[model samples]
Target: MSGLWDIRLEGSLETLSPFCVIAPGAEEVTRANGGKYRRISRRTLYRDGLRDSRPVVPGSTLRGRLRRSAVEVVRILSGERMPLAQWHQNAIGGIKGSDSEAAFDVQLRITLREKNPVLALFGAGSPWMTGRAAIGDAIPEGPVETDLIGGARSDDGRRDGMLFERLDADAAEQWHAMADANAARTRYKKAMRDLNATLRAARKGGGPEEVARLEAELADLVRCEEAAGLMSTNPVSMPLLHEAMPVGVRMRHRMMLTAVTEAEAGLFLAAMNHWMRSKPALGQHESLGYGLLRGEYDLWLSPAGAGDPFSVGQAQALPLGTMTAEPIAGLSGVPERLAGFMAAFREAFRSGAFDFRLASEIG
Candidate 1:
């Protein structure tokens, strides 16, 4: 016998440090100042019959973070050294080879779900399956405040707390090499453009010999450009600016799981547990002390039908505080419920509910 239950988590996240998830195409190099800057991601919404643009942490981004954390949990708890790339594809949905690779294979997908609970929960794309989980964008609870922060990279390593007098000869050599590589990249780009134009003209009226020669030159220029790109580095001693949401910004978020088995729910909850335990960070520049966040959530699990295999009761409240130092046992009101779910996950794992061997068979 099989049963499913619905789970919902309502949450709020507060940034403990500066955070920035840049808008698409918003990071650009300014020709006037030769400086690069990024702007925060935003979406337009209507409120009180008026349109307003607001900063948003995209749902896709949150899903990606959770998926990564979940994969890590799976790795640790399963105690198996499965191929990470293939396992990730199975858990998170990726194009195996072509989009239609699994277009006609239905039994394979059913077998996949039976073997891999993580894949069953998260779904896959090649065979066009729907996932049980859904995450909403984190929208600001109040007015969004932004700050413009600036940083610099010095070739002399002075900005990294190194003294200019102690700069090594290798630093100077690297700087010159990077500069030369950048120059070569620019030259290759210009030459490629010219060659493309010449090729176009040759295709219209010139001989095949001219066309072939221009095509070969353009291909060679492309290879050279790629090589130069690998060696090119950012201009040192220049300021880079980022528009970020400063600390203390609070955002409300929601995640939902529909029609999931206890084992599947446990798998997700276990991942969330690991994520909270590991001090999860979001957005960008975590190394620069940005994107640190504190999360608080109230989880609600709907009751399973009578005589069903599921055991959890209705309306159980689970409060999750990601940054709290208190132990699970020390916390009030919901530790037992959480522990129950975790135990279910553990039992399922012990019973071989999750099979990593199916990873290689998934498209």
Candidate 2:
């Protein structure tokens, strides 16, 4: 349990439609007075002594949101009750206590530092699961222009489905490819069957002339089969139906995580992959169709005591050496120490063992 990684995610994003991140504004906020919310970017000014990039989505928010998404995945996989939002902040914001009737004061206070996989990956027993991973604020690669619209509501629950049924991004392309391949396969089989039937009838019935005609027809069918095979090899590509996208949109993101076990690290990677593939995040105001991006992450793993782990020089898609945690002896008493660390392991990973559900989560 030593080799931990500093993972970096780089990608570009374009919305399927005009959307907003929902910056705060007054009740009477209007477009003219600057009271209306607009898109933002990570920037800074020299006016402040030591400047810091005021991010469109800060490191804290990025980490927390991703962490929450990860936790949700872990929760489903592990069957733990990791809430999605909080005072207790989760990316799926706006939480009023859970379905539990018990008041906050009556909630149990015994913080058990078990060697639970989720807790070890993301922190638990606190309002925030500041997990093992730390994601930096996404810096913009281009301008983040905003557009105004009305009738924004949260009733449109299935944004991902809408993405396939609507826009033609990578996700939509995937769906279309599957459908077309199935149809092409069906058509090819029917043509082959017709050719065989014609050949059988000609052989059973006629003379040389008729047999020659059937053979010629069979040759035509063979050509059709060849064409079908070619089509199968290279299906007609659909142009991305992205009339909703605007110009100059992309961002770069970086993240680092420490994992004592393979499961922990894999969990983090899985969560990020699912989130991006789903295009769930770009910023806030998702209900109005804001924040959907595509990307893949690169990883660099180093031993725990590596001199300069922060300096990620030439990290690849996987870890350098495989690291595995030695099995624990028992689970009787409390007094956590690395005896079964569910604490001290960052905020993201500290809940339960990973039980990922690919169909519902990733697929």
Candidate 3:
């Protein structure tokens, strides 16, 4: 039931924790760092001339993440037999023919491989035609502000786990030193006061000058104590940290399609459903509980205004609006073909034809 329809997905990408989706160019960076990150909040460039005041999640990033997530659904449906190498072979058709699990029937497409439905959906290989799926970058719908969080640093030095360790050590030592020295400090202050009093009463030469010097020293000690107290309260948590993207920013991705069938649309939405339903995160600091997002998906059979539009929502929440009339959904010959493709793909995934890769296994 598709014909000249566009899919406009509107919903808030509610972040469970602070998440960041920053690129090298516009990210707030440290001086001499070459690439910017943190240091300050700045607008992020989604593409040339499309800069957002807050960092926006890139569509490519989301697509990659969703694709990887779909691997998990494939794995669970297949029970853990599929590994990364084999799984990609099935999805992209790198392996030989007998692989019934291969998503793209490369052997079948030798005549017009570019016309392969799955490859055509994701724009395989390039140089022929644009991808059928028109996924767009997600931007915050409301005000977004940055926050700093210590994330376990990566092997590449994006964040250093030891940074927190060292800070903790220093804080502990300083706190202990201050606690132990508190009595001594009090005694020293009292003695200085007594000496100054005695000198004042004696009216002796050099007494005022010596007392003044002692007073200055006492003032310095007081400053040290204050500093130690503040440092002791210093956050001695994780070491690796960065300026994180603001959480709670609403987002929407308007995916417009020129002509796509039910199977293609179903497979695409099903994969995305796995992403939204699952708790895997997007962007950086995933371990530190950042990038976790929850959203809804809505499919429109046609652009609004072309008589009432037929639509379906993943959940009760529906993000609706008028989109361009250039794109449309195909109604004929989609389900049967796409269903067969999906079944084989799932079978291959489940039968270990495609080895699924988890985030933990990623380098």
Which candidate has the top score in lDDT?
1
Which residue window of length 10 is worst by lDDT in model 3?
323-332
lDDT, candidate 1, 1-363, per-residue tens: 157777777777777778889756874644344445766787777889988777877888777776766777778876767675666576567565565654557787777776666677777775566788988888888768688777766545434455534777677666567667656655665676667879999999999999999989888877776675643455555456778888888888888887777777777777666655574667788788777666666776664433245535442423342322111222223445555766787788887766655434544
Report the Cα lDDT for candidate 2: 0.45
- Name model 1 segments beyond 4 Å from true: 23-34, 99-102, 155-233, 303-335, 359-363
Ranking by TM-score: 1, 3, 2
List model 3 lDDT by residue over 68-153, tens digit each.
Answer: 55445555665557655545532443333352434544444332322233443554332222456777777766546777554432
Q: Model 1 lDDT vs. the true structure? A: 0.68
Better of 1 and 2 by lDDT: 1
Q: Give each model's whole-structure lDDT.
A: 0.68, 0.45, 0.50
User: What is the C-alpha lDDT profile of model 2 across 214-259, one tens digit per residue?
Assistant: 7888788678767766444643332111112242355566666654
Error of 3 at 251 (Å): 2.3
TM-score of every candidate? 0.70, 0.43, 0.47
- Specify the highest-TM-score model's number: 1
